[model samples]
Target: MTQTVTTSAVRARASSPALSGPGLFTVLLAAALPLVDFFIVNVALPTIGADLAAGEAVLELVVAAYGVAYAVLLVLGGRLGDLFGRRRLFLAGMAAFGLTSLACGLAPGAWWLVGARAAQGASAAAMLPQVLATIQAATSGGRRARAMSLYGATAGLSMVAGQILGGVLVAADLAGSGWRAIFLVNVPVVLLGLVLAVRYVPETRSPRPEPVDGPGTVLLAVSLLTLLAPLTEGRAAGWPLWTWLSLAAFPLAAAAFYAVERRADRQGRTPLVPPSLFALASLRRGLMLILPFSVGFSGFMFVIALALQRGAGLGPVPAGLALAPMAVAFLFVSLSGPRLIARYGTRVLTAGAVVQGAGVLLIVLAAWRDWPHLGFGSLLPGVTVAGAGQALQLPNLMRIVMSEVPPARAGVGSGVMVTTQQSALALGVATLGTLFLALVPHHGMRDALVVTLLVQLAGVVLTGLLSLRLPRTVG
Candidate 1:
């Protein structure tokens, strides 16, 4: 009986189509777009506000809308890819993303940009899961290892590059388009991605795709929206009555969603996020680390961009370039992650968290001392160490999360993981960004920046503690 099962598995492996070299590159390029857009708007927000005559309230919406939409719909997007062809969904989503990006660039007002950004986020949700699913289904052994490592590296680098590139684009004001150039730039890249995808990317889908979990999907959506919406918009909108009510409803909605999903799993039906998936120790523990790391990372990005530009009185180029050392450190360190993991195991993550925490503290000290005079040189040491430490954590954490997820359930697994990461990102912006903003009026910009960095340092420490629980040796 065991021999027969082994033979069947071997035959299934033989029949799977491989993801070619160019195909892998195309999907990685696609993966980079959504993450890049998430951070790209940070440095450009001031310009966007001026050009559109948008207030702080409306400006927050521009970022929140996209993040909420992306986080809420990601799991559903993955399931759809499993039912339909991954390649088909990838192409369709890419087309929608391009169109929405065009709308964003052409938007005549603040509300128009917000709506377009939400649409763009939805499109990203549809496209990104397929990249991970394809990599899981199409590659194996050393090839799979290499591909996964590259995907992790790409994810980290793209995030840093997004902010850096945004600063440059806003400063350049190409074709006199100003901040709009940031969104408009995606148009040409998406067109190129679509062409490459069609010619090189292979189609893949689940062998026995389950029907969509309608109840679970709706409940999950409710749970996320109720929690995220009010938190992101509440302070900006003067903490309206609706925000409090929404916050009150969140726990109930979350409880209901969990109960429904659990019941569905027990009855041998597939839920949107399978309860069984977390049985993988690597995935479960790795995700815990990812949540805190992503939250702190995003919050720091948003706050630092604002602080350098407003408090330190730097131009967009200088504000963005202040983080250049971090980006360079991340890029170089990430290239060697696979080798480090092979030798050091999960210890890399713990040490990374310590290193990152030190960097955050250094920045806090700099802010306290330098105040309005903080520049690229003054901020160099902290950002470089922070970036190097982050390089160690994010890529390895991602590889660990997906390490034990079954190839057959790759779409859902990737979706679950990305959703967790994305939700934390939104929360980071809402929570830490709000804290920083709230403090600025009372404590002054310098004090607020210091306090925010200290808070982020605590998060880094928590991430280190969580990393201790991850499987000693990842798959």
Candidate 2:
């Protein structure tokens, strides 16, 4: 009877109260961890390769494994949160994340670390969507908007900070851990997050949660793997025959996944990805902007890290510190984002793109002229301006995404949005990073870096044009 009563009470806790300040902080912290890990390894990769005796192909696997796993499992993780309870899932995922981080840090070999990183990503898939879903369900009106804005700020900041922090950690070599310090650092933070979550986070779930869509799940996984797997690994693997075969299968798999989900929606079943969800113009258009935005952001981070260290002959610390101006600029502009949105609305995005383009051009000029001499001083102006422009775009863009998503389907909405963002980040690394590396062998690093930045500038232009279609006023 006591056990039965406890079960009932657990279920009774589903209707969460408004998210408190501490609760919001807790979720936002959790949110930053995954994204931080995504880019953290950039500065640490060289040390990791040398220490583990791993080659380029295996090193690429270490990054791609995490990204693909994170992207593939995200929606399912969100759905599970809805059915079981979000707070419950958050705790479980956080625990798993801490354990996997420890595993990555302690691994005896490169393959072991790669496996652990994949697990780390899978755990992130379970944890991250809950951050947005919790905000969507537990807050509303202006509070909802504010919470979303904060989440976005945290996300954009984390991506930049990750590499910075990784450089610090790797250089510090605390207790002689070297590159292992990056993964080990997550363990302590995760433990703190777990404790705070239990105390401050509230239980929430769909009032009418649906069962998992198994077929849709499988097809979605296949679709992402078919495209991302080959691309991320192809260049490293020397474009193997299997990579070509996988790339060829991507379209067919995507088509089948869409048809399956559309059919499920038509049948009145809750598909993993509801086609009806895209009917929300805000979500749809916001996602369209996110794809290019994330692609450039991630690609630039990866390529710049490589170019600075390998081409400019900088160490990890110097390479990461060169972007300090960008991080500082991003923070300042991001804080003012809500005010700007209220005043100028979507025009801010266009203005941001233009400013960001100018920043990119400045960086190209710096790279072309400075070449091996390019250091923090030479790169400062361009990176600072670019960061500010990105600040205007990323956080506000995120607010526009969930602006119109209904509260009940918040889990699914957050899942879909994040999946798109994560997949794009992976592709950015795959495509832009590929382009830069491919150019380096024939063109040398300076020309390759300049060309890559030029390509990214083109993407910034595309993002600005897409922003024009965004609703003038996001709710």
Candidate 3:
């Protein structure tokens, strides 16, 4: 009789109505923090390099260190959340992130700052997977859609806002710390998130607990670190032999990781990432699309930020403000995303890709026409249109990816998706941004920017092609 009562109560909690108002707001806020940190540091890089007298390679590591650590540990973090409790991990991660952000703000040396940044990324990995997991476990149907949409919008907006906020803080030089202010600003925001989260966020985890695949976790981390670390830091560090070796080993490591996970799963063990998760066609294809989409997006932002500041002679503020049109356009179009997805389904994503491609083309043309005179006004239309296109796609893509993720596997699913995205983003900045910079010395900045935009256009086309494989409508 006691066992029956306990089982019924568990089901009741799982089937309860979705969070609303403050509860929903808290989740979305938590979701936005990692993305905000990702782009925020870009505009501050030059200032940091200047103030710290850091070399370009070390500076690139500062960014890459955070991203690589986050991407590598994400799956394990998710598994840990499932084994423990998402709320427990979320609170702990958020607290660590705040403290690390403080460390970043107060670092006296370049290496110390880099280490802190890595720690910050690890904390983000711990915190981020829970946002989506909690939403999945706690919400369903229309409520879930709304929560996911808000999460997507916050992500997109935060990416833009990070850069903008970084500029403002760097320029303001709060407490006369210059670029350090960008990180320092997070201290108060994080404290607030911690306070609200404790009050409003409910605890959640997999109802049927599963054992962590220890070996799978280790292998997965090795695979990601081997792949992402080199790709991100390689070009900046002049592509050492170890970088080439690491890249070469990626396929082997990935295949081995897969083999091990598949073996574990077949044995009725819970691999850190279950193969069953990919059985959902929408989730699989949606993740495929996310990779290229995120890669291009990050590449564009990183390359453009550098071009604007170093090439076009803009300050941090102006460079950051240049992305404002994209943010505005994204916000406006994203509000109508769900309705559009309901009507047109995956076709909307295709349309967004085409529109984004056009925007990139326009950017290429603007670069061609404006040459040395490229300015915020000149770049506005292209970026605005591109932002509109992205707004249409990103939210819908997110909805599709999470559509079929069983509540029980939500943590792992979110972890897998986010890891793919964050890894691709880091690589994009590393590869595309590297290509642009490499070309800048030989061909002028104008030509370099145009070429990079064209390459990104190809990525957008790939996204369009992949969209056809996505389910017509999300569950």
Cα RMSD to the true fold for all candidates:
2.2, 3.6, 1.7
**Tens digits of per-residue lDDT for model 1, 1-475:** 9999999999787648799999999999999999999999999999999999999999999999999999999999999999897899999999999999999999999999999999999999999999899898899877887788889889888888899999999999999999999999999999999999999998889888878999999999999999999999999999999999999999999999889989999999999998889898888998899999999999999999999999889998999899999999998988888888888999999989998988898888888889889989889999999999999899899889999888889899999989999999999989999999999999999999999898899999999999888766778
Q: After superposition, how far is residue 455 of candidate 2 from its true place, in Å?
A: 0.6
* Model 3: per-residue Cα lDDT over 339-360, one tens digit each: 8887887799999999999888
Q: lDDT (CA) for every model shown?
A: 0.92, 0.93, 0.88
**Candidate 1: which stretches are off by over 4 Å?**
1-15
lDDT of candidate 2 over 309-355, digit per residue (tens) = 99888999999999988989998898888889999998999999999
Candidate 2: misplaced stretches above 4 Å?
1-16
Q: RMSD (Cα, Å) of candidate 1?
A: 2.2
Number of clashing pairs per prediction, in order: 0, 0, 0
lDDT winner, 1 or 2 = 2
Cα TM-score per model = 0.97, 0.97, 0.97
Could you give the candidate ranking by lDDT, starting with the highest?
2, 1, 3
For model 2, the local distance difference test gives 0.93
Pairs of residues clashing in candidate 2: none
